[model samples]
Target: MPKALVTGAAGFIGFHLCRRLSAEGFEVVGLDAMTDYYDVSLKQARLDLLQGPDFSFVQGRVEEPGLLMRLFSEQRFDLVFHLAAQAGVRHSIEVPRDYLDSNIVGSFELLEAARAYPPRHLLLASTSSAYGANTEMPYRETMRADHQMSFYAATKKATEAMAHSYAHLFALPTTMFRFFTVYGPWGRPDMALFKFTRAILNGDPIDVYNFGDMKRDFTYIDNLVEALWRLAGQPPPPDGKSVCAEDSLSPVAPWRIVNIGNSQPVQLTDFIAAIEAATGRSADRNLIPMQPGDVPATWADTMLLTRLAGPITPIPVDKGVQCFVDWYREYYDC
Candidate 1:
């Protein structure tokens, strides 16, 4: 069986990816720090669902010295997914040091390890927030994303550059995918969909930032996972040319960046309405100004993703929101 190493295995995206890889007959090694960014119980619960012979769990920080190096040496992963990072825009503002440690230094450790033991494919998760302050309607991989409004985005952008250098120098096959707003069952508590669901079910006021004028191209977890799985097998060659016209293939390395998103931006108010429709409760809106490090809109141009991974049929926001609500009720016994 193929050996796969997934960092941040306890994270929302990492958990889903590990489960999917394991079910596909891969020997999966999941590494997570299990940080209390929200609740350690949630991470533990996700880990419980992934416990099986094919899936092994490791409790450790990726930023720790020699942690990833040791694992990579022993496991010799055929595929590596670097999904672990300090995730949170507002929180980054509060503690920018965490972003430097996890996003920058942690990635440095992983890159060094991958250099020692090269994987068939190394996929790193990036965010659409890296497109910071751009007013572009459909943000594409080829667009300029240098001006990041938040420290979180700056670190992610920096990682992309760092990964690219490794791919160019060490001949490491790398693919960095930019995720829009990812929401689904087993979502993180800090995300809007999860927070909205919990507050609405409890009959509490849901904070509506920017007076509900924001928009996001929310990608469903299942669809994103499928895209990721397919991409794993379709690593870019060292020829440094795009197979498709819209491809973001690098000019000097076996690396590329793809945006996995629904490609359909939905309004914030409409998103809340979907939650209301799902929960059968009207939300008490606490309209407020847009917080710092927040963008008014985010839409992805998924042409590159489609070209590389074949056709991607994304789940609609309303349907996706309902799925999360159903899971939340079942999990919390609402």
Candidate 2:
């Protein structure tokens, strides 16, 4: 079995990815800080489901001085999925230092380790927020994304540059996938879907940000994971040539950035309505202005992704919302 090291293995995306890798016959080692960012119990619960002969878990921060180096030396992972980071746009505004430590410095540590002990492919998780201040409707991979609206996005964007430099200098095969509002089973507590579900099920008001004017691509977890799995096999060629007209593959390095999203932006109000439909309970909506470090909209141009991987058929918002609500009811006994 191919060995894989997945950082941030307790996170929403990381947990699902670990499960997918194990199911695909990869011997997976998961590392997590178990930080109390949301609920440690929830993280533990996710970890509990991952215990098996093919999977192992380690608890530690990715920014630790030599933790990654030790793991790389020991495991010599065939594939390294770097999903660990300080997530949340609004939270980053309040705790910018955390973003620096986890996103930037943590990525540096991972890169340095990978440099010392190279992997076949290094996949890093980025966010659509990195496309901040771009007014374009469908965000293509080759577009210029110099302006970032939040510290969270700024740090993530910085990682893309950092990873590119490493790939150019060290000839590492790297892929940075930009996620757009991922949601589904085992989602983050701080995300809108989780918070809204809890509030609506409890007969409490849900905060509708941007006065319900915002829109998001809202890629489901399963779809995103599938895209990632397919992408792992489609690493950029070492020749540094474009794969397609819309490809973001760097001309000087075996590095590329792909947008993994639904490519269909849904209004925030419609998302809440999906939840209401799923729970059979009407939401008490509290219309609110957009928070600091929050964008009004996000849409992805997945042409490059389609060209690289095969066609991606994303789950509809209603179906994905229903799945989450069903899981929430069973998990929380609501």
Candidate 3:
């Protein structure tokens, strides 16, 4: 079986991705810091489900000086998925140092490790927040992403640049995918869907940011994982050949960025409505101004993704919301 190393394997996306890789017959080694950003027990719960012969877990921070180097030297992973990071737009505002350490320095460590022990493909998770300040709808991978509204986004963008340089100088086959508001079962409590479900079920008011005026291309967890599975097999050509006119493949390096999103921006109010429908409860909507380091809207352009990995049909908002509620009700016995 092929070996894969997934950093941040206990995180929302990391947990789901590890499960997917394990199911696909990859011998997956998951490494997580298990930070108390939200709830460590929730992460431990995810890890519990991931325990198996094909999967092993390691507890440590990716930014630690020699952690990644040791793992890379030992495992020599065929595939390296760099998904570990301190994730939260609002939280980043309060603690910029976390983003700098985990997102930037951690990525640097991973790159150096990969440089020493090269993997066939290095896939890193980026956020749609990297598209900050771009008024353009349907964000494309080739678009100029110079202006970032949040410190979180700025650090993610910095990783993209850092990865590009490594890909150029070291010729590492790297793929960075930008995720747009991913939500589903086992989602993070900090995310809107989980918080909305919890609040609505408990008869508490859900805070609708931007006074329920914001829009997001909320990609479901399964759809995002499916896209990632396909992308893993379709790494950029080492010769730097473009797949099509819309290809974001670099001219000098075997590196590219793709937007994996639903491509349909849903209003924040409608998202809350989906939660209400799922839980059979009415949400006390607290319309509030947009938070700092937040954008009014975000949409993704997945043309390159489609051209590269075939079509990825997204799950509708209501249906996806229902799935999460069902999982929450069972997991929490609510």
Over 4 Å off in model 1, which ranges?
none
Give per-candidate clash totals.
Answer: 0, 0, 0
TM-score of each: 0.99, 0.99, 0.99
Off by over 4 Å in 2: none
Instruction: Give the per-residue lDDT digits (tens) of candidate 2, residues 147-195.
Output: 9999999999999999999999999999999999999999999999999
Please provide, for model 1 over 17-68, each residue's C-alpha lDDT reduced to its tens digit, 9 standing for 90 to 100.
9999998999999999999899899999999999999999999988999999
Pairs clashing within candidate 1: none
| lDDT of the structure predicted as candidate 1 | 0.94
- C-alpha positional error of residue 118 in candidate 1 after TM-score superposition, expressed in Å: 0.2
